[model samples]
Target: MISFLRKIRQKLLSQNRVTQYLAYAIGEIFLVVIGILIALQINTWNQQRIENNEELEILLGLKDEFENNLEELNFSITINTKVTEACVQLTQLIRSNSIANDSDLLDDLLVRIGTFNSFDAQTGVSSEIVNSGKLTLLKNDALRTRIINWLTLLIDQEEDILFRSDNYTMNMMPFLMKHFPLANGELTKKLPFDKKKYLQNYQEKSPFKFNIAKEEYLEFENQIWHHKHNNDYVSINELNLKDFLKITLQMIEEELNKKK
Candidate 1:
């Protein structure tokens, strides 16, 4: 094509057709510019295609991660709900004064007292996107904002988990160990703390009975307060985390629907 155009220009020059040669020269320059523009446009299209594919992959990965997170979060919520209910039952039983000698009730309360539930959201895909500077690839403004907000939500939940766990560790466990026998028994497995010694120490009673003394009852009340505190703290955060997961999952579905 270049050779043919050059031959035309040479012929025009040889004939001394200055007006025709200049017109042809301008036309040739216009064609070259058009070709360059077309090449640039094609390159841009190809780059965009690659980016779209990457965004889809990230979205799919996030979908799987969040789906699993949602399941775990729901389960945690259920467990925490049970903990809250058990706390309420124990509190009522202690406050009533009518059920003080109910050893069977004590057994149930002991099992309930040992329960704890927590959740940790998965951030593998989100962390990669944020760290690698690929958040812009999300394309959907709503989706990107929610994905960024997930980190903040996760941090809040983790802080609450730590706070509640500290309550159980520093306040509740020490109180229980000091006042109660904590003998080795089947109940050991149910409690969140170290069960090895409890398992080895008392193998006779499945649910060891503790005679509720005045001081022990007082300590039980104190321990129940801490348990309730932790339960409330965890329950509220768990609900919030669940809500965030649900909303983010909805946004992901919307984006995926758009792609389909």
Candidate 2:
């Protein structure tokens, strides 16, 4: 193509058709500019296609991740519900002013609360995505940014959910294990059938109010119950979990659909 252009220039100069040569040269330059623009447009389009494909791949992976998260959330809710139920039972046992002095019932409640562990062992798809940093891999920069934001909220909420709902391990469950009076006269670090919420429905209420050996069991029960009267475990959990999860996942889907 260069050789052809040079030949045309030589012919025009040989014939001394200066005006015709200038017009031809201008026409050639315009064609080259047009070709360059077309090539650039094609290149840009291809790059965009590649980026969108990558984004699609990420979306599919995230969809799978979210599905897994949903499943795990379901399971978490089940476990937490059971734990809450146990806590409720303990509350009832203590609330009965008559049972304040009953060692057997206290022992049973402690035994029930004793069965607590960290729900951190619960694995979910959202957790995997966050850990993998794939949540940040979304290709739509805007959408990617949104995903990160919502995912952070989701993860934080999940953690809060466990912390508030269960509090089973260190903060929640009853360690019924008796702390025999130490030789040093120090108390044992055991619950002796005693113990102690918000992502979804936790009302920040102390889940347990009874200690098997507390001198003021009767008073504690009344005071704690009065203070926690507004703590509707089931209703609060349902409301918060419903609202948070709905907003989080919907944000995820909206961001996905915005992808080209």
Candidate 3:
């Protein structure tokens, strides 16, 4: 093509026809410019296609990760709800001075009060997308904003979980240890050994014999109230996180459908 165009230009120059040669030169320049623009447009299209594919893959991965996170978060909420209920019941029993009437119920509530579940989210895909600067590949403005906000939500949720965990470890456990027999919590029922035999052994070998009758209920009730408050906070956060995950997942699904 280059050789053909050069030969034509040479012939036009040799003819000594200035007007025709200038017109031909202008036409050739226009064609060359058009060719260059077409080439650039094709290159841009190819680049965009590659980026769209990459974005699709990331969205699929995020869908799976967030789904898993949502399931785990629901379970944590359920467990925390039970713990909060236990706290409420224990408080009521203590206030009514009827806790000693039901030793079994007291033991069960004690175990429940000390139990907790943390929302351990799966953030591998989202973290990589944000940290590696691939979040921009996501073309949807709403989706991008939601993802950025999701990270912040996790931070808030973690703080609530940490507070609940610390309460269980530092406040509830110590108070229970001082005022109640750990073995009476029915934990031995889950052990490999026979429950009766384990309880007997625990009773015989235990250094501290806690008599609930002699223990003050007011201090224990205060601890229960504090732990319950922490549980309530965590539960609220988990609910909000669950809603965020659901919305994000819906957006991801919409994006995936667009790709298809």
Q: Which stretches of candidate 3 lie over 4 Å from their true place?
A: 187-209, 213-215
The lDDT for every candidate, in the order shown, is 0.79, 0.52, 0.84
Candidate 3 yields a Cα-based lDDT of 0.84
Residue-wise lDDT of candidate 1 within 1-260, one digit each (tens)?
Answer: 88999999999999999999999999999999999999999999999999989989999999999999999888888878887887888788888775546645655665665667778778899999988999999989988888888898788778878888888888887766664445532443354444464533334663533455665777778789877887788788888878888888888888888888
Best by TM-score: 3
Candidate 2 has an lDDT of 0.52
Residue 240 deviation, candidate 2, in Å?
Answer: 4.3
Residue lDDT tens for model 3, 1-260: 99998998889889888888899999999999999999999999999999999999999999999999998889888888888898899899898887768766787788777667788898899999999999999999999999989988989888888888887888788878877777766543332223365443233323545565535676778889999998899999899889889989999999999988
The deviation in Å at residue 258 for candidate 1 is 1.5
Listed per candidate, the RMSD to the true structure in angstroms reads 3.6, 9.9, 4.2
Give the per-residue lDDT of model 2 (tens digit) for 1-260: 99999999999999999999999999999999999999999999998888677667766666665555555555545544544554566577666755546544444444433333222322354456557776555644655564555455556555554544453344322332232111111111232223241112222323344334556565445433432332234324444544554565566577577873
**Candidate 3 clashes between residue pairs 3 or more apart in a chain or in different chains:** none
Work out candidate 3's RMSD over C-alphas.
4.2
Model 1: residues >4 Å from true position, as ranges?
184-203, 206-212, 215-219
Candidate structures ordered by TM-score, highest first: 3, 1, 2
